[model samples]
Target: MMFEENPPSSYLTRAAHSEDSQETITAVSHVLQDQENTRPVPADNSKSFAASGDLPAKPISPQQRLARLRLLMSRQKAEYESKIASLEQRHRELQWEIRDTHWQLGQQRQRHRLAEMRIRDAERAKEDAERRNEMLQKEMEEFFETFGEINRWK
Candidate 1:
């Protein structure tokens, strides 16, 4: 059986389903049973494999299978760690972006408030100037009337 390309899980599934010889099926089943019994329990850290460095309970003389399994486990662990690091970095970047957006929003709000205040101030100044102009015009009218009367008397 050329199962070099397929993973163990798929290989086992294919073997189990195919119409292979009874002896082959029995041998594969025994191997799978042994693997299940010897599989290490999952742990929180990557050091789990290092902590339990014991070989399988039924050690096969052909070290190829054991070495292949170890290689697969290591590759899986490395992939998971890489994914976790990438996600952590992405999370940090998103947090910084959120903070920057919040700061920009606050700045825009402040600027909007300042603009509103300036508009109000400008309107107030315009009203005050109009009132002063009205007062000056009335005073000038009164002075001109008084001057005309004095000139008529002269």
Candidate 2:
């Protein structure tokens, strides 16, 4: 009686509402055989429940669920912030270590260059000392040549 009393506004919803009843399907089949026309109204979905998630399923509404799911794979809120901060700190430490290593490398290279120059200077000094010793030895031999004649005469 209530179904007969009130018909829904939309034709699609009205037809869909009718299809919920066995008598309506029979009537619709007979009407189709006789070549009749009918319109349906949108169905009420207040009592329906979604198969997944806490949100209701709609024709084209996903922004709400998507926003909630954006951080689904991420760490918890404050924990992620702390993790990022810690990672950045470690990166800064690594950068400082790299800088220190480069500086030490530069210092070692300078020492090597200076040592090479000193070695060359030392070689030259040693050669000059050897040359002076030979010149002194020849002068001493000339001085002893006169003494040898005096000793032979005595």
| lDDT (10s digit) by residue, model 2, range 112-131 | 99999999999999999999
Put down candidate 1 lDDT per residue, 8-69, tens digits, no spaces: 54544555577765644454555555565666677654554445565445554424554555
Best by TM-score: 1
Poorest lDDT segment (10 consecutive residues) of candidate 1: 1-10
Error of 2 at 15 (Å): 32
Model 2 CA RMSD to the hidden true structure, in angstroms: 20.0
Whole-model alpha-carbon lDDT for candidate 1: 0.69
lDDT score of residue 106 within candidate 1: 100
lDDT of each model, Cα atoms only?
0.69, 0.57
TM-score of every candidate: 0.53, 0.45
TM-score of candidate 1 against the unseen true structure: 0.53
Worst 10 residues of 2 by lDDT: 1-10
